[model samples]
Target: MNTPTKRRGCFRNGCLALVLLPLLIFAGLFWAHRSSQALPDRFVLVVPLSGGIDEVRNESSSLPFLPSHESLSLQELLFVLNHAVADERVREVLLDIRGIHTSPAKIAELRDAVEKVRKGGKKVTAFLRSAEDADYLLATACNSIIAERGGFLLLDGLKVESLFYTSPLGKLGVQVQAAQWKKYKSGIEPFVRTGASKEYLEQINALLDEFYDDYLGYVSKRRGMSRSSFEALINNDPLVSAKKAQTLGLVDGIASFWELQRQLTRKVSGKELARDNDVFVSGARYRSAVAWPQKGESDERIAVITMSGMIVHSAGEMGEGIDIEMLKNSLDAALEDKAVKALVVRIDSPGGDALASADMLQMLDSAAVKKPLVVSMSGVAASGGYMAALAGKTIFAQPLTITGSIGVYALKPNISGLAEKIGLGRDVVTRGQYADASTPFKPLEGQAYNKFVGASGEIYDDFVGKVAASRKMSIAAVDSVAGGRVWTGSRAMKAGLVDRMGGLFDAIHAAQQLAKMDMGKKLQIILYPEQKSWFESLLQGRSASLSDRFAAAVKQQVLHELLPQRQLTSMATFYEMLLTSGQLQMLAVMPSDIIID
Candidate 1:
């Protein structure tokens, strides 16, 4: 057939495929939606936030989510927590943070959610066989925090770490090319050089100082002490003993499990209970979500979009963390709704995908045009993660919240030398120039390297310009901190990077203030999309097509294993993850390294 005839045939097929796509999508959504309604006879709200969200790196082992090393998503797992809230048949709420797994943000989120349930007249008893930061944070949110008689209460302050590679790379014939507009744009230096450059050290020390300051400040706030007092206690401060921690007002009181449970039951002796919060909400909540009047609600509306988990390029939250498509769909849906007057963006991430970050920033810029967009920083928001927040009307980061790292970087490993050494090499044939720009078959040339660096510069420029316009700061001011340099929420606020220092609840409050609502007025928060059911989880693996499983496996391995990860990286992935409210626990390191040596 001629080219025109083939094109015509292809066009005809495309139209038919388009027609069938929506029907299939609707059918699947409906099925999934309905399936969630089916509940079990007894459901235990398993809120295990013992570890931080693990990123996908090159893997040596399978099943990172398995028991040996379970990377729990305290954000996504909030559904299991729903079982404890306002349930008449759910006699009690059990919090097992003893064998903890979580980032401070997840710990805080889960803790707050648990606290809310306790406030709703339910008995919440947290049992920690031993105590760690994971146990302590969640314990504070519980009605009763029980520890083993001689268990420890590890409430130590935040610690920062970095992996220096400059020295090691030199021993080998490896060459690393690094460039950026700002002094801190040393994200690539670590791969080729060991030890940090003087400038890198200065920048990191400042950033870490701020991070530590914020952590101390926030812990003080939670513990009902002044930041000064907390700092005074932190010099050489490892909790010598749990008794000392108790004396220092780090915990309410130390008690055995039985005693803790007894106190909780007594305190919760009178309130109503249920199997799950759904029944309680159905039976006795303020107004039925089902009720509708002939007249619509007032013109006033607020859109809350959550950016959760490690942001990636694909499906936002289907099987993995933040997917741009998932978030873009949510943003588009909310924007299209006339009732949505403004948007509250919840950003939670440790950053990923520089290109993805820029794409999302464009999406946010588009959304901002139609409605006011405010960003809420959860836990650690850095690098490409913070890039996504630039388009918001205002950005909120917790005092201890990690922010900054407004930069772009890309790492392409060259295995050509290894292949040659092993006498196993592959040849490439390209139809056009630059076809091998990023291929692993050979080391990048000056031309290719220059091209990549230029691209990164363009991205960094874009990042600064957007921030400058959004925050109304000068280009120079934004440049000072834009080169993958991180900062604390407090420091960011001072630098105008973050608009306010606050928590999720505080973020909601700030959003309400922006919307001009009363301080005490309750704004009905509409969570994005919805959580999937247990059956879906069980069937999610079952329903996976060969392609889906293959994709998942690749992602799991590439991100978790093959991918050489650093502490703070990927501005793009961070932003997307915030949309889904997933946990991302990244290592403690600068975006890149710079060597003064």
Candidate 2:
């Protein structure tokens, strides 16, 4: 028989073993997973392009072990493609396109990257399943385009739809009194009229024509066909079957995903793949396994600041829109840093508050005076977005970018009828004549209306003045292009509003040249207003509170249940416009909301 002390020691040892066993197993598995991340000596890198591609990666999950559903960023994808160009282990790039959604400008950038990979002696193939026009455009850049059997290719032509809220708002006893700078300042039309005005339709049609021509021209030239022939093919069969697409020379071949994989294996390794894991590496895995090349041995740095979304005065805790305060802080930091030699500002906004835009323009102008500055316009940069770009020594935009709506407007809502309908009453007492002028219970009239109009006109004049000074044009010349007219990037370049037709990398190269840095040498690129992790944002109280989240959820549910999708979207747009303008503030927003599909 064992002694009591021996028995106690045995029990303690058993408990310790139980706890340590799981820990040891977990550690072993972690190491195994890490080791498995290594790339095969010769493998095809599968890059999945799906959903919305953001400009920067956002960390959604706080825990490393948890799965993340975040969309991949263009920068991340470009980085991967650039690295693959040099990595000998990467035999080829297989782009798996599945309902990819992004701007045409981004698609163009990606297409260029694909061509670069091919030039680097690596074959790039695109695999499509139920692809659309944008998806097909990107695939055209690949060496060969393969589609799944029974898949459909939707190549419908482009059309823009503008929503009007005047009738519905009138039904609800709400009237929006608006003042616009000129005829083309049609941002107010949607709220004031039932349909698009002549000027709006004219500009929109021109944009569509340009986009259609460019799309047809690129696809035709790439596929070694005449533009007229390609256009006719699209017109005849807007939605063609994968087999039909192959017959029309749109795709190279049709095969099942498994068959494609087998073919790729044979092409790369000269034999069919015995195991999937041994021959193929995912883009995510490759990103983690391979290290990015180090920058050249230099102390110089180039700071890249992205001003996206609406230009707001401040983002506060919500972190929505392009916060001017955050941007100013980043600019100040870059200006103070001795290592930072140049700055490239990437803007993708549809404009917002006039004052905020002016502040941004001023800040950028000051920075430009101190150092080399270049502006890169993404997707839509109009109105106040254009205002901000005036500070750049040289501005760059893609051929399809929507820009230039240089005007201002002011709107005030009169809800007295609604209050009456809802049986609400209020009695106001004020010493000043205009103290109650901003109250929604009363419509702005007489002196109040005059004051609002005067302020808006002044803002508009200031906008034109800034443009004239920046573009080296006469005030009259700038005013001619002003009046809230939107222009495609190519048109903007022709109008002297943009200096170059290029993308983000082109702007960076221009900055490097201006800074007198080596053209071939790599420099440290620092992104402004660095993205924060979800946990970090929460710790800093930037994430929404529980109450706010609940309120937003309830509001969304109520709207979805009450209104049709189209009407709800229009209402939401109107609400956002109101929020952006605030009370008695002039707005330099786009003439109309535009989304290219």
Candidate 3:
């Protein structure tokens, strides 16, 4: 019954079907991956806290074709917690505390957020497999703390260590010539001395004492124990098993993950579930299911500009530091936007170039004149970072924030001995007396050293003057607290350096109040220096290409194979800081390399 025309038509239809089938399948898979899963009627939100917690979200990925692995930021965590407060469907919040690495300031912020969740009528429980000092501190904010049967708690006291390279560099025949404006400017001490100076020792011991007292007070008060008892317990047994922790009232219960899930199910639904998955929703999925309360469609907006890392004149790589040009553009855009009623500048920098910091301060001041500006200091905002913050109408910092290193220093490396050891020499002819002042083969002395000292003094005086004007204190009072002295936010507040002791959210609320926005109504938030995807960054020249990145990785591998990686890396980093703005520039930075373990 088949004819030639019928056979041809059948073949054509078969070919078309084969091509369409693969296209349909591909489309289906894409939709499935992009779509959000349906939420259950009532479920406990499980939030896993781990890894390094940053202040802002990072969108870069190694491979452009694949999605980047999500890392948690304080902003995102806060957004989720704030949304959960009003969400009636969420029965409870389960914080799965793992190996979390962040500053004490961030930990304090998160603890406050957990307390706010409890205040909103939802119980927050912390589940720990093993806990460190910071983990225990955060867990105390929860309604109850549950630990795995075999877990341990390491409650070791805090210790800060300072590394010095003076001996090693001397062995290499390289001497560092450093001139600081004040005695307390210990940033250069590590380069010049084998041990900490007396002044530095005094400052560091004071900082540690304050931190230890604050830590003891917070933990003891939260766990319903006297300070002396808690101090004695930690001193006696820095490490405790789960059973011991329970008996000591540190943990409410010792149970496995499944047991905790069963208890949660019974508490929420009045029945135990056969499967743990039936009652729990992950924080990642929950984020997709619920929209942020502050991100409502509103014409009124508050622009948040994040200035993290060192304050540099320009960055060679993206996110290298707070570049002056980038800050200028962000400020200009916020000032120009009519919808932006207020601005919140979050600073988390240890400071860098003195000139760039002054530029940033000027930009913020100009922006503030047109609209309200508030500064929120993160973990470490010292030296030039503090200078830039002077423009804020009000400044907010957490209790553990390290701020106020109001001084300047200049460093010049004299490598004449190294050159002699290596049998290398240079003959120079100069027209001017100070022409060779910056040469590495010569040590800065006589008129050259005097000139640099005068410059540093001027910069230091200007810094103190700005702090005095901003804090409304006399020059003597400001100087008394200044001179490269760092203080915690609580002490800074008492010293009249900070207007309030709070976190980023508090600063946002202050901005909202200043803008005259109704506190009950949610307003939109606009992030400055807007986050970009990897592909977009490549296209816009903000990020290096794949080939360039590959080359960098190869070079890093080769260096690790060739050298003592840690020491070499440290030296390279220090050298980079010296040359960040090109030439031997004076730095208004802090002793940021100190490690608090």
Candidate 4:
């Protein structure tokens, strides 16, 4: 066919496709809705909480066109649990918590939801194989906890570990120069000190003590054990068998999957149950059926936008972190929605890219002028994460959440000695005397070093000023707590850094009150940055295709067996180079690292 003829045919095809698309979508949705409504009534809902729980559902792992059988996001699980509370068809909930791993803070949220389910008069049974500290903590909220025989209950208490790089950096002939506005800002300590400083140790120990006490108290209350005896039992036999756990009053009993199902059936329906023939509703299917609100029902909405992982200036290709532009877009959308009466910013990050944080804070502050804005800090919301929280009218955090670390630092790596050891040297040409001052071949000295000090001072002062203004404290008062020091949520609340010592639900409650919504009524939750549908994602190329994902998975396995990971070292080196070269300036990041076990 000629070019004109071909163009006309293509145009006609496009028109036809567009016209039929909505009808096709309606038909598909209608069939699925009808089938869901036709499901048999009055069955036990099996909520299988397995694998890692994420803040948001990860679309990268599943092909857009295919049905996903992956682990549920925290939001989805909460939705399911809440739905079951009012759902007449769901007689009970079987919590099949199998080999699931998550942070303690997340466990607290899940535990709260489980408690709500129980309060709603639904019996919740937890089935487990091996019970870790977090897993058991969650199971405590359930009415009955059944563990498999021979399974281990590793309830060793919490310990926080940090990594220090001062010795290693020194060996590489790199000296890190850092200045904090005051003491307690220990973010740079890891790069300059061999071990935790006395101040840092004191703060960390106090934080750990508080967290341990709270956890012990909760577990003791839930299991109906005295705190003193529970502590002794934990210390004496932290890692015990399932039977020992039952003996210690940690779990209800030991039973296999089949046995547990039979028990659940009898408990739920007061009758005998079969092996694999029970009509149990999958949590995912149940969630789909009840996730949406009833049509034409008027419910006030509170928009929740989650910012998890490192906060960066631009899009990250591989890292599962927050992007400034993406967050800005989400905020704009939430603000524009008339249905959304309030906003909640859920921040869980270790801090990054100070400039990006500033921009986001500015946007958040602007948004708050029109609507109530609240922050829910999860896990680690230090430095930039804390900065973003400042934009909220109120900040909420868990008792163990790591907050603060309001500080900035610059790292300059001088590898002159390393070059000498390798029989190599470099001579730089520059337009000005100070042009080559920060070159890697030499340590910054005199005027060059002073310039960095001045810049860091300004950044620190700016940070303190903002904190004071937002927190309604004097500059000196803010400085006392701002010196790059990390604080537990309880301490932060005492210091006026956080308004409430609670989790996301608390933040939501605060937002609801601020919006003047009916507290007893169900407030519709609207997630900002709406998840892309399969078709939308494919059209936008926001995620990888099925073939591409498979290839990447295979490549990862091959590389895992063949290569050593030097990426961490290389990334640090590159970052130092960038800072020294004046390409990247300032950082509002947590000075220390944390790993909880």
Model 4 TM-score? 0.83
Clashes in model 3: which pairs?
none
Best by TM-score: 2
Cα RMSD for predicted model 1:
11.7
Global local distance difference test of model 1: 0.58
Model 4: lDDT equals 0.74
| lDDT against true structure, model 3 | 0.80
User: By lDDT, highest first, what's the ranking?
Assistant: 2, 3, 4, 1
Please rank every candidate by TM-score, starting with the best: 2, 3, 4, 1
lDDT per residue for candidate 3 within 455-503, as digits (tens), equals 8899889988888888899999999999888888888899899999898
Q: In every candidate, how many clashes are there?
A: 57, 0, 0, 5
Worst 10 residues of 3 by lDDT: 563-572
Give the per-residue lDDT of model 1 (tens digit) for 1-597. 666655464367678788678658656855764564454333333344344443211122332232223333433344334434544545556665655644444455555677678877876666666676556656667665555667765556555456765455444433344445455656555554576677677776776565455456556766788888877665557553656666777755667755654554454443233333332211111111112111123454566677765556775333445668877888887888876666878877655665666687889889888877788887677776787888777787766566787876555545455556668857788987888766655666878778866776786788788778878889999887677676767778888898876655566666667667555543455555433322343235677764465456546655654443433334233322432332221211236321110
The lDDT, on a scale of 0 to 1, for candidate 2 is: 0.80
Give lDDT: candidate 4, residue 77: 81
| Candidate 4 clash pair list | 184-485, 185-483, 185-484, 185-485, 187-591
Query: Positional deviation of 88 in candidate 1, in angstroms?
Result: 11
